[model samples]
Target chain A: MTDEPRAWQVVLEAIERDLLDGRLRPGDHLPGERALSADLGVGRSSVREALRVLEVLGLIRTSTGSGPNSGAIIVALPGGGMSALMRLQVAATGFAVEDVVKTRLVLESAVAADLAGASPRPSLAASVSLLDAMESELSAAEFLALDAEFHLTLADASGNQVITATMAGLRSSIESYARLGAASVPSWPDTAARLMREHRGIINAIESGDSASAGAAVHSHIAGYYAETNFPTHRLDDMPA
Target chain B: MTDEPRAWQVVLEAIERDLLDGRLRPGDHLPGERALSADLGVGRSSVREALRVLEVLGLIRTSTGSGPNSGAIIVALPGGGMSALMRLQVAATGFAVEDVVKTRLVLESAVAADLAGASPRPSLAASVSLLDAMESELSAAEFLALDAEFHLTLADASGNQVITATMAGLRSSIESYARLGAASVPSWPDTAARLMREHRGIINAIESGDSASAGAAVHSHIAGYYAETNFPTHRLDDMPA
Candidate 1:
């Protein structure tokens, strides 16, 4: 015989089913602990536990005061939840650093090409500004951080939350990889200048509606850095046709 | 003034840094709880808490009785960790249904094309068998179950652990989406037959080493189902080059 689900899991699943069925939605308030416990036939503690996990997962926001916003409100912000999951998984060493970068190459390249080809291209205004900010004198760490933001800005323009979230999740690994390359680099200034140029090249390619060049530019920008850094890249010759 | 770090987070980060530095590797036993607390200057309970989280994330294994094998040992089995994170995120309604499928289309299509172009093609014996099994007499539910597995089988055969995990993580949504389509269709047999044929078309194209056609076939198969089912698909024409 199958084992019964845990009490908190029962509460969690019930809430999830409701959300899936449109019985609950973003911006809706969850029932209070006592009422949920009674309705779901679980203890108040189980309800609380599920709620705490939900809040931590960025599904709901809870405030302590008895004001109108005191209770848990569904916000459905998936990006933060995705980021936390990926961060913890990375910290746990569950993901290999190499796989993280490979995934990024696939997603970010797709995002750039998608941006380049859209009939009415989403504004690269934010991305352009981030690049402008990159030209300022900054530490290797700061420039790489802005570089990470620039890539995320492109993913954001794609308006695909899944790709955006996945890119956001892998942000740290991408930065860490580039930083390792920077560390071994002979001169931070030279590497930074080259990186800024490559970044500008990518933006220019996209803005000119050159999807092939935009995608290839991103692939080369990332793969080129790793190649120079002595990282064993997944053979780029075999990238998606 | 800066607040002190959470005790458990300090322990977690310390372990993570060691993992990043190649100090703690998969299958290496973690220091005993007492030793870890002493080394990190955290309470014993904090050490235990961090270990508990790590175990839950599938990064470690712990057992009781204080035997030689009872200590926590690193296990970098990331699939479960990725799956759990995604499942919880989906449960929280943190990911949109459309974005999830859109991601699947992108990843699975790329995976199929990658498989097509590999010099030493990874075995598709597993995938072939799954497809053969699908042709047998089965209800829509059983056929759909096999269908989901077939997609994952292709992803697994790609040899990219991240794509494999992401596909595995998205399995439920894929199945749920298909089941919805199957339920609403006027004839399950007609749809199933068409789906089976499309599945065969994808495999054949890959086996023939037609990377472009292999990729296009997959994109069409997925986008087609969503189209026939009245799902609002992200435009397939804009798929990655």
Candidate 2:
């Protein structure tokens, strides 16, 4: 296997398979590089290369030194790292901005509905306060930052780490385009006011335990803003009208 | 910057910032290692490490040989690589399986609804054929391959690459657990028959252009399968009942 094409990939897959089988897990220290290479019958260089990929993917952390923590240890999925990768992918690949907005509508609406349906409904106090903060005088940049925080809070309220992480990952890409779109709004104050109203409506629906309304409010809030900016509203039409 | 902690990270962020600002894009070739090192004031090794990270993230592909394509060229996001990383992450981190299911319900339901609303409705003929093929006798692994293809087709039909990529990435992890859960079903034949029926129902709803019913059917089909399998169904309760 070491002599085969992409020898490092073989080592990566071996580790990945072990992970999938639950043989390795978070906090489990990987064997030392020399030992791993010997066990897998691959060169130490191959083992090191494979570990580099895993580390970049947030699967493991390596510490330097002769201490107990020197070797690689499996780690929790690094949400921030995943988000950074996603933001970069979205930026470099030029995935259609409209498609991202549509995707957000689907995910955010579901998140809002999920939060609304939770038995002991998650508190929207943090989210609502963001809305309140928005009502005061602020620059578009400041308002957009809070706006993102509000949506991220809603995603967190869904209690699904995957959803939360994904939303956080896409936020920067979404915000970049949103900031561009914000520049086109006829009136910043009016646009901000409308956004605030929509935010309040979404919060109220979630607080009142109205799942359908909560979903609808989220969908409308996102779609309305894009439509107002005249930024290719065609995709929004496919969503609930 | 070279003396800073994680200097390679500085190189990575510099390129990422350029990508985000639209200074870099798909199909563009990155500067050679020497030039990047000089421009970023980092060592060539740091530049190489940063490039390797970007390559693993599917943001670029490097070709060897002193030809036109020898350098790292920005590439479209590689869905398969992302999927592999996600599967490994889910396995190593023990991200709650139930959280994955709930996230699926949110995503798949939205995809079904979106397909139903497409103006020149995306064809479900391929999807319908997969359902037809599943009716014949097959092993669990065979059935699962078809099942994944079916969901992926629906995701593709929604016309959002991001959602499609995300669904594709989650499919393997979901399939691993779903296969395990399948073992506990009271009657395999009964469960398979019910799944087939639900697939047809979802297809019919989409074909008839009833977005709401299509979404509802997909939601129920997934939630129902988990419920019947006696797999931890606690998370389903948080979704809209």
RMSD score of candidate 2 (Å)? 6.3
Give the top-scoring candidate (DockQ): 2
In model 1, pairs of residues that clash are none
* Residues A140-202, model 1: lDDT tens digits: 888888988998899988888878878887776445556777777778898789888989999
Q: What DockQ does each listed candidate score? A: 0.29, 0.39
Can you tell me the CAPRI class of model 1? Answer: acceptable
After superposing the true interface residues, what Cα RMSD does each candidate give? 8.6, 7.7
Residues B1-241 of candidate 2: C-alpha lDDT, one tens digit per residue: 5565676788888988777656777888899989999998888867776777777777889887887879999886857555756776677754567777788888999999888887899988889889989999987778878988998889888778888877777777666677877887877888888889999999999988999999999999989988887775222223232
True contacts kept of 1: 0.36
TM-score of chain A of 1: 0.87
